[model samples]
Target: MLNKILLVCLLFSAGSSLTCKWMDRDFKQYSESALALLKTMKTNSTNSIDDIEVDDAVAFPNELYKHASKESREERLSFVAHVLDEIYALFEENQTRASWPENTVDDFLDIISQQANGVRRCAGKQTTNHHKKNHRKMSLYFKRLSRHVLEHMDYSADAWEFVREEVRIHLHKVHLLASS
Candidate 1:
């Protein structure tokens, strides 16, 4: 509990201390779209499952794949598995609390599984054929996950704000890379 508090404090301090404007415009655009979807989920509105926008999701995985030269094939696969595992855990933990239709929940899990399979299939390959499609899945998964968190998690206001800011930072970095 104390650690979470400290982490949130650190994130808040770090975010406030940074005056970087290089990625502001791109970050604003990216965060706004994602945040809009998240807000719909928060209100339990009827949003299309296809409303998941993952346009900025490809940058990190592409970066990882490109920089895998120093690492062995096994290492790269392990990294991908680790990421998938976290997503899986988050899905399992929050699936019940989301209160979406049963079909929607099941469909979301199917998408998650497909994403995992795609990562496994391309782990050590030169090309990521599922890059764009998997990114869309990732974005959808995040919306559902955030909805669960917003509705069920016991995070304080500051902590929730910190999470949003963390996402903003991540999207900003992804945008910077994608733009360049």
Candidate 2:
């Protein structure tokens, strides 16, 4: 009788596992969504630079600065500088990431410059396909990213400006795509 009961228990566990395997499709869908973004980025890092989601890169800095700015000027500057360092470090990280192509400074600038006006124009053109509410959300997300950059970093010549511009525009494009 014990042997029969054990066999039944094992069978029940196996059936549950099989059921879970079937239910796992939802998890796979999210992963596939992420991969689709990766594929888009990889294929058009130059064109799609506008499409990469970069808000995650600046999120911590933005939140930290929001509170730190209430403190002394020194604390604010400290937070800002730290934010700059964190964003700057992302370039090296991208080197390891598969989707980002061989990005030159020029390619970065080309994509970044297309963002500010291009986004609003694209939305306007997409009026038939998109609604105003969704565009507003996309605008807000881009605003958050832009405000983060404006608060934390300065735009001067050299690698910093190139990278900053690229990041700003890329985040905006990503926001636009996400809302759609």
Candidate 3:
């Protein structure tokens, strides 16, 4: 009984964090039309350009949304912060892995919030100005994220190359998510 209760609590915690992630992403779009565009993104099987096309996107927002039904906002951020921790751990695995500066939950929150805000902004805007606002916001957020990533990037040549490749895969997915 104790083990079952612990498991339930763990699952509950996970659900909340994922919901927060969804909430953050959903809030980014401001306009109804923009949302329709976002909804059009295709679900993808691969996360790399070489494996797929840079322009090709399998937008799976539903899959992402379904995940939100389980968590509260704080739980969601904590969960994602944990995921970020793991990613960094992988990057810093090797003794020669170079400097992968530590990232806090706030860092993940900063990035997630920016991305979500962009999406929410797009969703809220009315379709009048040929999507310039949507594009501009996404571009700005993406650029900021790229900069943050660069700041924490590993300096070792081999490690650098690997993480760069890793980032490319993730960025592609982000592009798919920002389809609106």
Candidate 4:
């Protein structure tokens, strides 16, 4: 009886370990795909356009990255997933105004959604309430940014460019987190 119990425990541990490894690989692949899509959207123009500035009241959370570094893998994944969700909503809301190729925009949004879904699966949570304050701040930041892009930007291209840059920066941070 003792032998049987030990055997079962060992098998379960091994299975759990394998599942974790598989999920990590899947998450990494999704993150990489999202980054690649962002890269393809890069523009060569360095000309400065008077773009809508980020609101100080809901500025990008630079400190969140530091906190994320210390967080558990699932916590970090959850935060990134939430951020991706917001980005998807932002782009989807303004899709009609973007001058980028229709397929490219669609693919970008699709990849972001997939990445968010992959992380949420690994974390086993649809949304996290751990850093509730930070999450709320982020949500507001994106909302204000989107409004600015829509109403303040001089042209549709400027708005799309701003969104692209912000997405690329956030995705790059997520990629670094995954690598770590």
Q: Best candidate per lDDT, number?
A: 4
Query: Model 3: per-residue lDDT, tens digit, 1-180?
Result: 999999999998786566545544553342232233222322232333243222213222233322322344333333233323333343334324432223422243345445444433333323334333433343343344333333334333333343345443443444443332
What's the C-alpha lDDT at position 51 in model 3?
A: 39
Report the error of model 4 at residue 115, Å: 1.2
Cα error, candidate 2, residue 69 (Å): 1.6
Residue-level lDDT of model 1, residues 1-180, one tens digit each, is 999999999997676435223233333443345444333334232543234332442223444434432355434443444344444444454334344344543454454454445444434344244443444454554555455444434432332432333344443433333333
Clashing pairs in 1: none
* Per-candidate local distance difference test: 0.42, 0.37, 0.38, 0.71
Which of the numbered candidates is closest to the native, going by highest TM-score? Answer: 4
TM-score of each: 0.32, 0.26, 0.25, 0.78
Every candidate's CA RMSD: 19.6, 17.8, 17.2, 3.2
lDDT (tens digit, per residue) of candidate 2 on 1-180 = 999999999998786556444223332343234334333443323433344334564442343223443444323323322332333334333233233445543343343333322323222223322233333343454455444443333321222333445555434333323222
Residue 47 shift from truth in candidate 4, angstroms: 4.0
Q: Could you tell me how far off, in angstroms, the CA of residue 126 lies in candidate 2 after the best superposition?
A: 49
**lDDT (Cα, 0-100) at 173 in candidate 1:** 38
